[model samples]
Target: MLNRNNLYFIRRKVTNHIMLSLTFLSVVLTVLPLLLIFYYTVTKGLTSLNLDFFIAMPKPVGEAGGGMANAIVGTLILIGIGGAIGLPVGIMSGTYLAEFGNNKFGNVVRFLADVLSGIPSIVVGVVAYTIVVLPMHHFSAFAGGVSLAILMIPTITRTTEEMIRLVPHSYREAGLALGIPKWKTSLVIILRSAWKGIATGVLLAFARAAGETAPLLFTALGNRFWSTKIFQPIASLTVYIYDYAKSPFTEWNDQAWTASLILIALISLISLLFKFLTRSKY
Candidate 1:
């Protein structure tokens, strides 16, 4: 005996509840895989976690009691090299695209960036090998870094452009109205405002680069011992994980899980640190 209006209202309420439930379910589904991976990694890795694992070199085959100190340092070094080459280029390219890219050349650059982003990481590794390793006549950390930088550039460039574009046009007008030069305004007001987003994008690129193993396989070639020279092969957590995971030894298998845990932890720590450091004061 409900009125038509009451029936319509009931239907609307039911629809809203159903949609909300659906969205909640979707979120749960999206997060479940990540949670499962983390749980399994933590459970398997904790047994192998020790001070030695951070301080000692990899043990010889069929032996025990070793660490990944060299791999850890090498990973940091590679990241440094890649960031040095990639960050400035990406930020500058993105700034140009956002501010002055409403033309054919900009379109071409944007298109190229998109295409580069879609290219497989292994393909990029091969390209770097051909360009760097072949010329040098050996695999090197430098080659690995070059491949990582290439992968980083496209993501950082597009992210930078998008973050900058999100800034209000009024901000630009205000800076210009104050008699600030266009370049200075873009550098100071615009960039400062968009820095948090840009930093997040940079961190994302770093995380992706850190996780890449195939590129390093073709470039760095995975050293077993310590090596700091840029021109020499270097170790990395991902490579260690790859090698250990494929080994027949149980110790190596355990270490692989530990290395995976370490890689995930490292990326998470860096991301949190970057976010904290780049948080807006105002």
Candidate 2:
């Protein structure tokens, strides 16, 4: 009996070591691709990254020494528009679902949100085209913004609901005992407590929207020159990268790499900003 027990203990120790090794290997495999991509992008993109790239407009065909100023501005504008339309609605919807949505209607809304999240982005773009572009008889930044907003909504709503739900029931009860109205408690206390997670969700949504190309293809309809009007075609970094990468010219290809680098940098900066904003004041 003593010998048998010793053998079993040895076997369990070996099995645990094997599992640990496998998990470590899996982590390395997962991170390797991301590291390689970042290295490759930086190496390739650095050749064309410069002040002019951020300040000047795209040069005409076969020309050299141009930038993506308009595209950068347009990308920011699109995100701003999407955030303006999507944030409040998503937060409010999530609050309702978490606070009062325990029945059939809540389940239906939750199901719809899940389905919406899974839908292809290109399909959303097409829907926006039909709803916004066709009526206006042309593609515009507004249509692009609408498509991005739709994409953002489900992620934000679901994230907000989960984050709010994580708040302790005691906190709610305490607020009620103190005579605070339910609406005020939900808005001021619950949301404030969950704001960090909600902000993360918003950042994720913004990053996804910023990188989208297919949706904007059918909506914003990339422009060559600078244009900021909501009803007009707009330039965006993803679209510019798409167009530039496909071109036969070497300069454009270099610019595409640089543009990709800028997009990544922009997203990173926004992430840092969100982190800073959400840092605990205590």
The number of clashing residue pairs in each candidate reads 0, 0
Those runs of model 1 whose alpha carbons end farther than 4 Å from true positions after fitting are 1-10, 174-180
lDDT of 1 at 96: 94
In candidate 2, position 182 carries an lDDT of 97
lDDT per residue (tens digit) for residues 1-282 in model 1: 999999999999999999999999999999999999999999999879999999999999888889899999999988888999899999999999999898999999999999999899999999999999999999999999999999999999999999999999999999999999988998899999998899988999999999999999999988888899999999999999999999999999999999999999999999999989997688
Candidate 2 positional error at 239, Å: 0.6
Residues 145-257 of candidate 2: C-alpha lDDT, one tens digit per residue: 99999999999999999999999999899899999999999999999989999999999988988889989999998899999999999999999999989989999998999
Q: Weakest 10 consecutive residues, lDDT, candidate 1?
A: 273-282
Candidate 2: list runs displaced more than 4 Å.
1-6
Q: Which lDDT values do the candidates have, in the order given?
A: 0.94, 0.93
